[model samples]
Target: MSADDSVLLHTEGRAGYLTLNRPRALNALDHTMVRRIDEALTAWEHDPAVATVVLRGAGARGLCAGGDIRAIHRDASAGGGASSRAFWRDEYRLNDRIARYPKPYVALMDGIVMGGGVGLSAHAGVRIVTERSRIAMPETGIGFVPDVGGTFLLARAPGELGTHLALTGAAVGAADALLLGLADHFVPAARLSDLADGLAGAGVPETVARHAATAPGGELAAHREWIDSCYAADTVEEITERLADSGEQAAKEAAETLYTRSPTSLKVTLAALRRARALGSLEHALDQEYRIACAMLTSPDLVEGIRAQIIDKDRDPRWTPDRLAAVTAAEVARHFAPPAGPDLGLGAGGAAARDA
Candidate 1:
């Protein structure tokens, strides 16, 4: 692999590892990177010499913070294009492949793993967390809906913890990731090299079994009781109401966070999660998410939300609905509606459809 490679692909003995190289941007996924990652995985999947696949980020601060939001912002600002559509279609396909790969795929999830980062790693067979792992979906904060199969994972989270995390862009540390079943193993950052060595020497299954022994409890472990109780509500409104009513400091803080996010995003996210819960597979979940994502780009909140947050660097986002309750059922329903055209020319209407 060369320095120009978006993902540094290499093989040591029977192990093939893909290192996300964009540390400056926290390994954020751009269109090129997404395509390369999928290509590497496809190659390694059939290689007789490769026994396992390892995914990691080059920088110490973040495995990947999210997608290249600057690109999305550019697209939304420039009024959409064939290129932008192609980006989402291909990116979603890569996410799907990771979720369904046959080989044992281990993600070294350290530092910030959010948005696009989650899409790449969360679906792996072995998600290994370090104490440095700080994870979230966080798309709501930027005016984008959480795609990358996040809807499926969020819907599957124990209770309303998913909804709370999504709406608030709440960060969860290593212990919490494991407790939430987001991580399969936990190892100290210092042990990452050793884990890689173990995987290469002993093969993936055995390595995973050993690593699982060292897995630790995460942030969600502490709040399980309260999270389960408060997050039981079916709707985001009800969930917010429960959080507001709770006397606990944690619950109150969560409520405040959710209240601060874009109202339109929170509403669409809740609906996406619920719809995902009823779906059959990760691809199905991403497909549902794509519909909402495409719709969001055309909606008022997205570009303005990005302008207020990332482009302007102002923390305040002026949401259209103002409050979650202000968003009507019809307004929310629009996000899930199909795009006007013949499937956007995405082929097959199969698992890959979500990707394109």
Candidate 2:
């Protein structure tokens, strides 16, 4: 149970483990940390001594909040700098590796898991959630579309829940996460230690499965009606209009949330979610996201959104479009255009035309 400073890389009996160690910022995935994780996983993949690989974050409050947005903001401010675009490429590659890793990957999703955290955990074979777990894809709130293969999982979610979450950045509790298929197992926080011990022992998978409790009833299932109806509309503007028309207190609150956000973000996000739904795999989704993300640094709304939210703490972002309805179809379409390059440096079958 002992931990180290940046990362705690150790072997607990037969299991190889890597724990994200920056608790204060909710273990946000920084560039260096992503490289370290990749290195550790690569080593573990071939290590005969390792029976299973478990990825977890330190502290009780969060597994990982997201990528270090402040860093990206700083890099973007430097004006198309060397490191800014490279970071996105490397991070996206890391996400792809995790999704295609060749082992039984277990993600201990104990607490708040957002953006980058979701990328790390969601694709794993076993995503274990506790009662305290609070998970979501909150990228749109920060003026970024959900990357980290978010499109793969969110697109696959039942009905319009994925689209709703991609747009609104809603947080779901453990029960809801289970019902939504975002998590595979639900275990109590108190039993996590015993479960980890079992995972490191002879009876690994069975032990973990035994400790898992079923998803609780209500909440997510009940709210599915409202979420589906509200998010089914064609555009963010249409969705907002529907929410406004509903007159329900929850719908009213949702409408307000949409109004307060950057219009460009909502537009880009909705388009990304729709495109991701049609994609075939995590690799495909990340590839599509890379094209959009490269263009994001040049967008006016991105810098302004980050400045207001993080740099200035103003909470007032003056998006370029000013209104969701004003974002033109051609503008949204620009994000998906292929980057000018000799090659995208992707793996097998990656160069083929994407479904969307």
Error of 1 at 217 (Å): 4.4
RMSD of each: 2.5, 3.3
CA-lDDT, candidates in order: 0.80, 0.80
Model 2, runs deviating above 4 Å: 1-5, 79-81, 216-218, 340-356
Q: Model 2, poorest ten-residue lDDT window? A: 347-356
Question: How many residue pairs of model 1 clash at the backbone?
Answer: 10
Residue ranges of candidate 1 with Cα displaced over 4 Å? 1-3, 209-217, 341-348, 351-356
Tens digit per residue, CA lDDT, model 2, 193-237: 788778888555698877887655536676677778988888888
Cα RMSD for predicted model 1 = 2.5
Q: Which lDDT value does model 1 have at 9?
A: 86
